[model samples]
Target: MNSLSRQLKQQFSILGAFVVSFWTIEILDIAIFSSYLDRFGIIPHNLIGLRGILFAPFLHGGIGHLIANTIPFLVLGWFVMLQETSDFFLVTLITMIVGGLGVWVFGAPGSVHIGASILIFGYLGFLLFRGFFQKNLPSIMLSVIVFFLYGGLIWGILPGLGPFISWQGHLFGFIGGILAARWLSSK
Candidate 1:
């Protein structure tokens, strides 16, 4: 296989592992833990709730929630990786940290937030802003493509979308993505 094909295969493998792990966790949470693992999600303002930053993205409310996030996660994530595989990792880490901390600091009191929306929004943010930061033809084109496909999702960041919707996570995740794009493109 050509180098490009080989790279795509590797990227798919890694992304597939991510999906598998998410499914496995969900299955275990339902079969054995009975969703008890959800408590590990962001609890906002509490000390122990801090762990949710790392765990929230992997925990979903139900099969529907996981299914909702799965396609966007894979597609946007693949777009980020198209430029450089390592970028996928960097963007994810930044999004998790920024988005998680934002939720911890500003999320509703006594609320437990759990979902992959944060990462999904993060990927969106990175892709949307990456071209602006990079100022290259390829980056610009990728940004346009991402915008056309997912631009409607921008509304998700606003408050009052729904009682269960973690708009803060989406907003913060997007911010984190912009930061990642800026940070990575600078180097």
Candidate 2:
């Protein structure tokens, strides 16, 4: 196979493994743990809760929540990978740190925030800003496509969507993505 084909396979495989892990953990949490794992998610203003920054994205409330996150995670994540696979990891990391920290700092004291929405918003942020930062034709075109397809999601960053929605995560995740895009594109 050609180099591009090989890269695509590798990217898809990595994304597949992530999806598989999400499903496996969800199945185990529901079937074996009785949703106990969810407590590990982000809980603001508590020292122990800080660890949730690393774990929250992988935990979900239920199959319905996981199902809601799966498509956007794969699609937006793949778009980030299209430019460079390493950027995918970097963006995820930055989003988790910034988004997680945001929730930990500002989220409701007793509420638990979990799900890949953080990463999804991060990907959206990166894609939307990458074109402007990179200042290239390909990046511009990709950004436009991503905007047209997912721009409606931008509203998620605001409050009043619902109690369950972590707009803090969405907002910070998006900021992290833009930060990542600026940092990466500069280099």
Candidate 3:
């Protein structure tokens, strides 16, 4: 394959791996582990819960949660990779670390936060603001498009919006995405 073909392949592979992992883990969490995998999620202020930073995005509370996260994950993730396929991987890692740590530090002390919404929100924020940080025309246009498509999701970051939603994770994930845009642009 040519260079462009190889890049597309890589991008698809990365996106596929993440989405498939989400499904696989959820299947195991439900059918095999009997939802016990949920315990692996982020538990605020708990020392042992720190491990959730690495695992939480992969373990969803239910199939519905994973399904809700998958489209945005693929769509926004694909956009992030538009600049460089490998950038998706870096962005995801940074988002997870920053968002996960925020949940650990500031999330409710007794609650466990699970699911890929953190990454979803992180991706949304990154797409919306990356243009400003990078200061380019195409990126800015892309940012506008993202906002038009997903602006309503911004409300999800607010507290007390609904039951079982981790707005803290959404807020921190957004913060992390902004940081990632700045950090990546500086590179």
- What local distance difference test score does each model get? 0.95, 0.94, 0.90
- Residue range with the least summed lDDT across 10 consecutive positions in model 1: 14-23
Cα deviation at 132, candidate 1, in Å, is: 0.5
Over 1-187, each residue of candidate 2 has an lDDT whose tens digit, in order, gives: 6999999999999899989988899999999999999889999998888888998999988999999999999999999999899999999999999999999999999899898899999999999999999999999999999999999999999999998889998999999899999999999
Candidate that would win on lDDT:
1
Task: Name the TM-score of candidate 2.
Answer: 0.98
Backbone clash tally for model 1?
0
Model 3, residue 73: what's the lDDT?
Answer: 88
Please list all clashing residue pairs in model 2, or write none if there are none.
none
Q: What are the root-mean-square deviations of the candidates from the true structure over C-alphas?
A: 0.8, 0.8, 1.1
The list of candidate 2 runs beyond 4 A from truth reads none
Q: How close is candidate 3 to the true structure, as a TM-score?
A: 0.97
